[model samples]
Target: MENCSCKECVSACLNDPGRLVPDDILKLSQFLGISIDDLKENYLVRVPVTSNGHTAYALAPAKKKGQRYIANPGTVAPDYYAEEKGRCIFIDDRDMCSVHEAKPFECGAYMGCRNTFLGKPYRAKTVEEYFYKRWKSK
Candidate 1:
């Protein structure tokens, strides 16, 4: 397969923010110079995993609702970043990720033209366990 530029993958992320594991959250917190708790409280949304009786965290999208997308006002994305609909809060005016270096595991492993790596099962399970532990402790 030819190496595809990140355009497609970046577009997909902009459309739908990916789910984040605990380690990803930690990395984002460190990158944004914020506490993990603050990040969770302000920028993450809890999604119920009913089958497992647990919850997963996904990054929040921009606030404006319309046919066009809106970049989060709180982030570094320029005000003119609005385009398309349902963009992730972290995508900037240039369609670049503001937190590219600390992107979630799924985003990091995604390859639009190749078989994607969904992370090791053992690692996912371990992270899930850790996430729940921390969630409950808080």
Candidate 2:
């Protein structure tokens, strides 16, 4: 927790670091109205099944496609679907999230894009505020 600011960490972790370090999957399970274990099993361990080959970190493989994006053989999921999946942990691109609020578990665990502020690198003050700042452009 070195160099950790209270508000920023709280914002990043999405719970009171005072009460407890929030279990991200647990929080997601609660929000999705599903069992924690089920959520973890279904989302965390399961990789997206993509036919374009693979993105390295994607939970599932990309579905097959007709030739729009050749890097992978399949059609890339639209931004909307990608966003819904959250952090797009399939590759090295951490900056491209189609969804933030409802992103998938892998996206949630992504620490690469944290601490960005107003186009500057800094700790986000809170999750709510961070989303407001990050996604307001869309």
Candidate 3:
């Protein structure tokens, strides 16, 4: 179980899209076989961003066997930025996610390339619903 102070846990949870609840923190601490304090100090890296797109919290997909974790270009038209104001986090010069290490677990589980937010096991309010609406539209 998490034996750390709320301050420590909150510091650790910042910018983490996983949004680990207290129970999850406890489970993770138990799984890591370390004190929650240590986990918070050593492993957690916070990177808070202004919430933007549906895929903001999406996990990076797993690489194919022996391949690297490269992000693919989204199906946006060339005039996407001209038409829309927001920026995409996935569009690196090399087509890789900058925050690949901190990506959510859902991205790691995705198999369908065309699918936006792949949520089947659990229901999240934002990205999950976004995917549902997108899929329904198609």
Better of 1 and 3 by lDDT: 1
What's the lDDT for candidate 2?
0.33
Q: What C-alpha lDDT values do all the predictions have? A: 0.54, 0.33, 0.33
Q: Model 3: which residue pairs collide? A: 59-107
Q: What's the true lDDT of residue 103 in model 1? A: 67
Deviating ranges (above 4 Å) for candidate 2: 1-22, 46-99, 102-138
lDDT of 1 by residue, 17-62 (tens): 5445556777888999999778866665553221257653333334
Backbone clashes in model 1, listed as residue pairs: 69-84
TM-score for each candidate, following the candidate numbering: 0.58, 0.25, 0.30
Off by over 4 Å in 3: 1-23, 49-125, 128-138
Model 3, span 41-89: residue lDDT tens: 5444221112234232211111211232112222222322222222233
- Model 2, 2-95: lDDT tens digits are 2332443333333111111123445656766778555544433322222233222222223212322212322333434432322222222332
lDDT for position 31 in model 1: 95
Collision count for each candidate, in order? 1, 20, 1
Q: Candidate 1: which stretches are off by over 4 Å?
A: 1-5, 50-85, 119-138
